[model samples]
Target: MKYLFAILHKLRPLFPQSLVNYGYHFPKAYLAARLYGNPGADLEIIGVTGTDGKTTTSTLIYHILKTARKKVALISTVDAKIGRKNLSTGLHVTSPNPFTLQALLRRMRSQKIRYVVLEVTSHGLDQFRIYPLHPVIAVLTNITHEHLDYHRTMGAYMTAKLRLFKSAKHAVVNKDLPLFGEINARLPKVMFSTYSLHESSQLKPDNIKYFQDHTTFTLGNTFYSIPLTGEYNLYNVLAAISTALLLHVHQSDIKRALMSFKGVKGRLESIENKRGLHTYVDFAHTPGALRAVLTNLRSLKKPAEQLIVIFGAALWVVSLVVYGKRLLSNLIVLKLST
Candidate 1:
């Protein structure tokens, strides 16, 4: 493929249109089909889709699988990896088209990966960019007010995300959430199991400490810990741990993986210390997401430390592009006039 692209690059001057056509199309579809279609590449695809927690949950799944010693590939909003190679052709957490997705899967096939975790988006589904692929297991993390402009309503948004269950062999749902009923209803043919990160029975966290920039939670027993903060992340890890258990992974291995799973980039990513304020750059755009993040930050912060969110009206940057839905792209960029 590199040779093919190189040869095409050499021949671009002679047959620009021919080479352009192939690059623009055919590859993601052709490569996905060639590598995974028909017989479908023998790789397991686990699609994680929801308004939030998809990235964290997807990463958690990948890390747990890696600890279990299975070769894995993942496509999240932040990055794409085939085994260990990062295949981020774009800076944003999305694939502009399906071809890119297919092409990446082709690379994964060559890596001899046994598992593939894809962060599926409603936008990707809406645009038909995720076709020609099947997820053996689908995880519905949660749903909130997001991507309304693209789907036009909460109902439409829910429908778009539910397609994960529609396309998977087994669907994993957060049973604590009310939205799961509708999603489960839509997946009449698909097998599903529920799991919760929320404290149930004897599996709750032993203790938790929250700071403005950092939060740590002790994993039920021993000295192991989940090295981030937020109730949402608790659910994310619970979802990942449940999937790991479903895959028949050992508890020891899952615990080991969870300890190492820090977080995804820009999802409340700390930008070092700016003066005295602990600045954080989060990939939150929607109303629900923003509210959750701010609330989490407040809960995690020390009593003495104050949090003054300086979004600078960057909300629309994520809404319109990240999820590919126009959730009223209204931003208020702050500038001190000279």
Candidate 2:
């Protein structure tokens, strides 16, 4: 079957795109689920999807649950944690293929893992790859300009993301995004639990403070501090805290988890050096993400220090001019090489 799929992949461009997706990928998902007895049906699943922040939010949710002494597993773009084992899902893949995904779910079920935080992508949702998994909670970080080439329009792209929320029993969404208004109009208010940084929502932070190495905020009258920097990261933390609270995790456990959780790799990851220089590596692909990352770094750097930026070309045809303009707007005393 692996060879058969490989052969079909080689001939995929020859067939109609819909036929290849619905005909080939659909059957693969169904077969994998049937073979694995649809393990997800018996598990408490949280599906996290958006243009960004999925990994951090999912991992944080898993961390809070695990810290609260719950048997939880996490499958993010960074890695998958099943009990004590850390397994690589794949290179450059968010949600694994149907076979690997279902197999992981089966393993989690056998181990009595009650909760699974799975980071899903728009492509994974649209392709019917995760067709058999029904999430109890769906999380949308935010939707911005991305992946328009495949979906052809922003409306189509947004619709693909909505599919996950439609399958979920409850949804946690970012209320600050304009997309939130659309989501609110479509889904029932009872199904939504919102979090926001600048607007009134169910979960809004207060008394926010930003530092070079960490951030402090107040949620639900309890002050929380995280070893992560950036306002965007505040949203990620809020998302996790909201989900953890929904699962009945204690606020004290959530505070401890937020303090201990270092962060995900390549998502504003700091590299230690002996030279007393601040260096970071991040997985910022879009202009909005680039702006957020740079904005945080600029706040941390000294006025006299030169901020150096080095980035490469994107694999897809993004508006390089817009990216460049965003980068330039954040540059003060800076050196840029692309």
Question: Could you tell me how far off, in angstroms, the CA of residue 187 lies in candidate 1 after the best superposition?
Answer: 1.8
What is candidate 2's lDDT per residue for 218-269, written digit by digit as tens? 8767988899999999999999988988888999999999999989889989
Span of 10 residues, lowest total lDDT, candidate 1? 329-338
lDDT measured at residue 205 in model 1 versus the true structure, 0 to 100: 54
Off by over 4 Å in 1: 1-40, 93-96, 197-224, 274-277, 314-338
TM-score of 2: 0.92
Q: List runs of model 2 lying over 4 Å from the truth.
A: 1-3, 314-338
Where does the lowest 10-residue lDDT sum fall in candidate 2? 329-338
Candidate 2, lDDT over the whole model: 0.86
| lDDT per residue (tens digit) for residues 1-338 in model 1 | 65775576576557544345356334544554565443334678888888788888999999999988988888887778776577774767564365566667767777777888888888776545576568888888889877675577788788778766776887878877777667767778998767654524223555655554344655555444677677777778777877787788888998788777767888878676758666778877665566667778776667777666655343345455444432332221111110
TM-score of model 1 relative to the true fold?
A: 0.77
